[model samples]
Target: MYDFLLSDEARVLRSEVRDFVKTIPRQLLLDMDADRVQFPKEFLAEAGKRNLMGCRYPREWGGRGLDWVSTVMVMEEIGTLGYIMACTFGVGAELVCDAIIRHGTDAQKEKYVKPLLKGEIFAAECLTEPRGGSDFFGTTTTAEDKGDHYVINGQKRFIVGGEGADYFLVYAKTDPHAKAHKSLTCFIVDRSEGVIVDYIYGLMGCRGGGAARIVFKDAKVPKENIVGSLHGGYAVFNTMMIPERLGTAAMTIGAARPALEVATGYTTRRKAFGREIAKYQGVSFQVAEAAMLLDACRSMAYTTSRAVDAGVPENEIRRLVSESKKFITESCQKVVHNSMQVMGGIGYTNVFPVERIFRDVRLASIWTGTNEVMSLIIASEWYRKYMDDRASGITRDCENDAVEAFAEGEKIYE
Candidate 1:
């Protein structure tokens, strides 16, 4: 299915990424885990030289001019290393760079997007507030116009890379009375302003990149720093949401792959009741089930990426994105859970990374819009198509006899 979904060039790109990740020192990953720090500069520089940081951007701006499939390939590789690397180098770049490349003027693109693609500048997305999570419609951050500049004031909570980011891709309300989706606006706010960052929140996992809260107390931002248009936050968000879902799905599946391998190895070697754990059908079946689910999700993610690359219609793309996000993230959560069960005692302990993988994958189902939100999107889309078709007067009128017979046999109910 991957071969059918991904082009030959995309497959080659995937192989290249896998080979690069294979040579990354295990100690490097271990140190990253131990130190709980952002990605080392050396790694980022190497990735930039290899064109992995900007794989999806056009070639005119120091990118490789590849499509989203190539981006997913790199994301999977980074996810294999750890969550911080994936967020900083893969997810962060996609979210920030995509917006700038699509909407920024030439000057904004040169200053922010190009350098970011080359890894000269790192960007962090600041969308969630102290009162906002999945519901980003109620952000209290306000960008007040002051002639040649705008003054931003509010606090952002749980912002990824809030403490150390060179540039912040922030969302602030510019028109409170506009429609709910369009009332806010996005900006490329530099850290030199009067922005105060505080590192206070810690989580069960993904601690390396410094997820902190930022307060902009009358922070001055140039009027030119606004991304897209004033009161156009929805457009900015809509442009990147699909890519965010697709990239996140790929990352989760990649992180789960190692857990699957560890569980398989443990079951084959660990002795229980004078036989290997693999001999127990109960344990073996769990591993087999997990493998299938992971494979299914992987296929869906790659397919969605390819569809996006082919420029599928908006309705179709939305359907695929919602399905891919829900399927891949939810399956990752289940697969990691089964892996822990297969590892038995060691999985629950810090001796293994399975527990960490488990916690990290759970965040996927919640991030980039929760799985529950995905369901709503899917249902709404399906209902719209159904109603549209019905309104078009396209209905089968001669199935009454068949419907009556089926109802008589099965007692169907609505």
Candidate 2:
């Protein structure tokens, strides 16, 4: 059905992920939400055995050697399971393993990336701190250089997979005197004695994957464990943002889609005033609008994924990636809310999955770089492009003939 935008191989991969998701029992999902299910290590092992964990990484690293679009497809399917499960999968493969593959030495890849993909060990990215959320450069975590090793001392909160991860891709300031962006360094920190999992958050939703606050008190890491060059962590961070934002957008589609399906089916059979609710223009219109919004979100996600696969310029990718994250996640929140409205009071109860979905979708706009942050990036990049065009003496206007004919003073903004 999505053949116009996705190739046959992509469609097949989507089916494979969808099939795997079906094997996960509904009770297991409930257990996860209730915090009865601990780590889901067995589930990760199953995914690894199926070659579905890190589909986008190189073949030697235990991935399927797929493109970004394929990774999106896998995430989209896993997302249908629920936010927590999808996030667990992403933290290991997309966030942590990808970072290692891109910046780690051969030894690091052999030790961490391979096991990470095979699900023998799990990994987490410890970026956000208690003091700063979006201000990544303002990290209070410090990695002091010793003669033979670096001693990391800091706390990272809201770290997904924090409690269960065998290792962490930790970022800390190595050169305090340097500028915020240049002072930082990335490390492969094992969950050794000095590393502590402080508290597992009692979240409003998306629970049971062990999101927690992690503390590193004089955690000693070898010099060889440094990811990329010391004090060059900003480049690694920038590279990571593309996958983080784009993957969030893709997963939001999966979360919203099931809710929409349920609502659509309900409206067809659900009666109001002695007739099926679908007969009413009010409910029908809402269903149509929600469907349209989901379609638009999916299109944007796929387009951005394809752009990444094609290796588009970094700046252009940044603009589109931010736009995709901001737009898709916000649209998903709307779609799920509308779905609840269609189902009425029953939707609010645990009887329907829409209520859970409603809560889960709320976090999509807030995490992986908040939608507000995404707006800042999108507008800044747009302005930069506009100024660059002006500097180059390019007089390109809107591609509409009527708009082109309008006098400069007649245009509203002009």
Tell me the lDDT of model 2 at 403. 43
lDDT of each: 0.79, 0.88
Each model's RMSD to truth, in Å?
A: 2.8, 2.5
**Model 2: lDDT to the true structure:** 0.88
- Clashing residue pairs in candidate 2 (N, C-alpha, C atoms within 3 angstroms): none
Query: Number of the top candidate by TM-score?
Result: 2
Find the 10 residues in a row with the least total lDDT in model 2: 397-406
lDDT of 2 by residue, 1-414 (tens): 456766676688778888889898888889888888756777787888777888888889898778888888788889998877888889888998878899888899999989878878888899999897899999989999898999999999888888789999999999999998899999999999899996475788888776879999999999999999999899889999987999888888988889999999999999989999988988988999999998898889888999999999998999999999999999999999889998999999999899999988888998889888999999999999998987887886554468457567665754
Candidate 1 runs further than 4 Å off: 1-4, 31-42, 393-414
lDDT of 2 at 155: 95
Per-residue alpha-carbon lDDT of model 1 for 165-224, expressed as tens digits? 788888999988888888898998998758888864456666655577889999999989
